[model samples]
Target: MADDPILRLRGVHTHIGPYHILHGVDLDVPRGGVTMLLGRNGAGKTTTLRTIMGLWRAGQGSVHFDGRDITRLATPAIAQAGIAYVPENMSVFSDLTVAENMRLAARSGAIDEQRLDWVFRMFPALKIFWHQRAGVLSGGQKQMLSVARAIIEPRQLLIVDEPTKGLAPSIIQNMISVFCELKQTAVSILLVEQNFHMARSVGDTVAVMDDGRVVHAGTMADLAGDEALQQRLLGLSLAAHQ
Candidate 1:
């Protein structure tokens, strides 16, 4: 392992009821790069993200960030440590104005004018709807707000789960651009996505999960070269481009 991996998980495991999810998962998220967790629908990708966020505590292994062991920290404590999570549902406050919603997101000395400017630059549509209520915004707009609000502070690492899920092609394109631009700020991103095209487009490293375990880990280029492995581990029905 490197001297300072932004985030690392070793032998992580989780369960719901009697069903165990993660089976001694190990991952190293490099600083200022995108690492995508790829797998089929039931492959425990979401469970891995949840464990990192403290929403699902692993019974074993350790989750470390910036050389500190955070596997036992509470969710709020983890969030205050500069980790932010953007779930797939895009849960924005429906009654609040966009500015109001963004203000609320700015927590523990997080929200600032510079952050606002960066978010607005990524999604000009958010600027247009600054005064509107969140409930009325389209799905794409809501997703933008959900992500932008989280970034209102200096999030050392951002975890987004299935961001492009159920979105229209146009909206998906827009989201890809937003995420790509965000990398310019040098924020490490741990992305959980099933969409092969989107993952390959933004991910620097790719890990394939199956049956609650990480079976393959490598750079995006390496994953692209292994067609049989992609099909077997990820069930990728089509060819993936680098």
Candidate 2:
């Protein structure tokens, strides 16, 4: 089964300064589908993501990706290993044009026209504003560009953190469609989101985190259907949220 999960974490503990954030976190991102990491604010979801990316080193335990131990690798090294991260901030270069941003994220120093065309299909705004500066775009458009940049090149896994944090309802629906399309591709996705509606829509598997540890893991359909389980684990029913 080790070959099945593209990414695995075991007892991952991360500390930022004197504050202990992630405490013995364990998770698995199965190959070729969306695995949603869901939790309330301050539930250590972000810390867990940062630790996996090697932005924050794990104090104990291990992180394995594509069958290799990457617990101690630096951020750049981890990225080079074919993992792409789209942080919540969207991190687009405000001064750079949309085309410039894509060029920067390509990593190969050259953007492939075919891959770009595919990305444009998924997010038409990027194509419309190709020559425009990233800072001038709307929040939703910026998020699309952030995602487009990540997939401009081939990747084994894509990790996104709270992508729908501040978008409108229509934009959220668009994001749902984007993730759905991404699932059909060869790349796997690990997503952290608070919107249960979006989470249940795109997620094939779900992991719930609380107090820095994963409290539940199962199919998204199970979590969505069980109002009692959702109320207990997530403090609300998924159906009610939708």
Candidate 3:
């Protein structure tokens, strides 16, 4: 692993039954920054994030966090090792109040109060809706709660999948700001996003995945400077955002 690379995956091959999804996926999430994973739907972006989180076993290859091999670790063990995963759906407890959900995520006193304070500061909306059931909150609110839960404990790495999906543009902007702030902390972020404009806004480094392989990677500036590369890989043009 490279020095200070918080998360790294090398030639990872993960298969679900007879269907192989991740084929030689290589990725790196550096410390104290956000690395965006961009791809078209069915490009295995979510699956790659899942594999990194150890939600499923990788048939071949190694996953490293803080310079330790974690490929064979169980999902709960991976989580206990200071990696947190916030899925595309923002998995909130629908039946539980916002406060209840947060308390439950603390893992019976394993979480840090200072971390919770930071998350609440980042998302004052969550503090405001503390008594409401997660099911009753709006989509953007749920996203905030999901993020809050992830930060309930002081984690070294954070993985977020499609966090902007179904959110209003205003909410997306707020989320982008939160990500920017999170990058200032020690926690590294690996994000899977189909939203190009948002990805461009927050991605320090980018890896474009297609057909379960990382086809392109570099600094965000590299991706932004090449219009042809952007158009070809993502079917996106910055003109559309203007």
Candidate 4:
């Protein structure tokens, strides 16, 4: 239902060794829309994504996805539940060809031709470099390959961290176009991004975290229109960031 959240985190706390990261993070990712997670550096944004992927175990609270509790589930099990994660590093196998890296990401051990065609439509560079080694591709092409791998199989949720971190302006624009197209597919996206332009353009919902807690949550339009709120929560206006 549109009223129900696809993913929910309630009073979630996470610890990395002795250092506590997420302090009672209460968040909701609505079904079939992009929910952009924004905050200043060290605001626990990345940790939050890691926690959701089971890279960091939540010390307290619950993570609910598709109406099931997944707080303590193993990483592979959590992934099996239909959540695909694309970390900041764009973890593509450098030594392998783009096709090989994509083939590995398929849980079924075989690529779906129709899905592959769809992905190519989103990122033509991947199709152009199908047989090329990942290490030889430029930064933007590598990022596209990484995303291609994630979407090679059907997924209910896609979580990405700083996908535009080091890309050039043109590449960022391409990514924006691709994400806009992905949004039309109706797959929920929990994106951790510092690029305010990308966030404003693609985010349907916005959540601002500060000091390990969600300090603000609302429609992206609301946040985008309020320069004062943006400054207070993010320490700068989106316009300034852009």
- Give candidate 1's error at residue 194 in angstroms: 1.9
Candidate 3 per-residue lDDT, tens place, 1-242, comes to 23568888899999988999999998887787889898888888988988888787899999999999999989999998999999998899999999889988887756566777778778989888899989999989999999889878778999999999989998888898899988888888998876777788888998999898999888887887788988999887755763
Q: At residue 117, what lDDT does model 2 achieve?
A: 93
Q: Tens digits of per-residue lDDT for model 4 on 1-242?
A: 13589999999999999999999999999998799999999999999999998999999999999999999999999999999999999899999999999999999889999999999988999899899999999988989988888889989999999989999999898889888988988689999999999999999999999999999999999999999998899889888867
Backbone clashes, candidate 1 = 0
Give the count of colliding residue pairs in each prediction: 0, 0, 0, 0
Span of ten consecutive residues with least summed lDDT in model 4: 1-10
**Ten-residue stretch with the least lDDT total in model 1:** 233-242
| Per-residue lDDT value at 16 in model 2 | 98
Candidate 3, residue 92: the lDDT equals 97
Regions of candidate 1 where Cα sits further than 4 Å from its true position? 1-3, 108-110, 237-242
lDDT at residue 48 of model 1 (Cα atoms)? 90
Measured on C-alpha atoms, candidate 1 has an lDDT of 0.85
> Which pairs of residues have clashing backbones in candidate 2?
none
- Which pairs clash inside model 1? none
Using all chains and alpha carbons, the TM-scores for the candidates as numbered come to 0.94, 0.98, 0.94, 0.97
Query: What order do candidates take by lDDT, descending?
Result: 2, 4, 3, 1
- List runs of model 3 lying over 4 Å from the truth: 1-4, 108-114
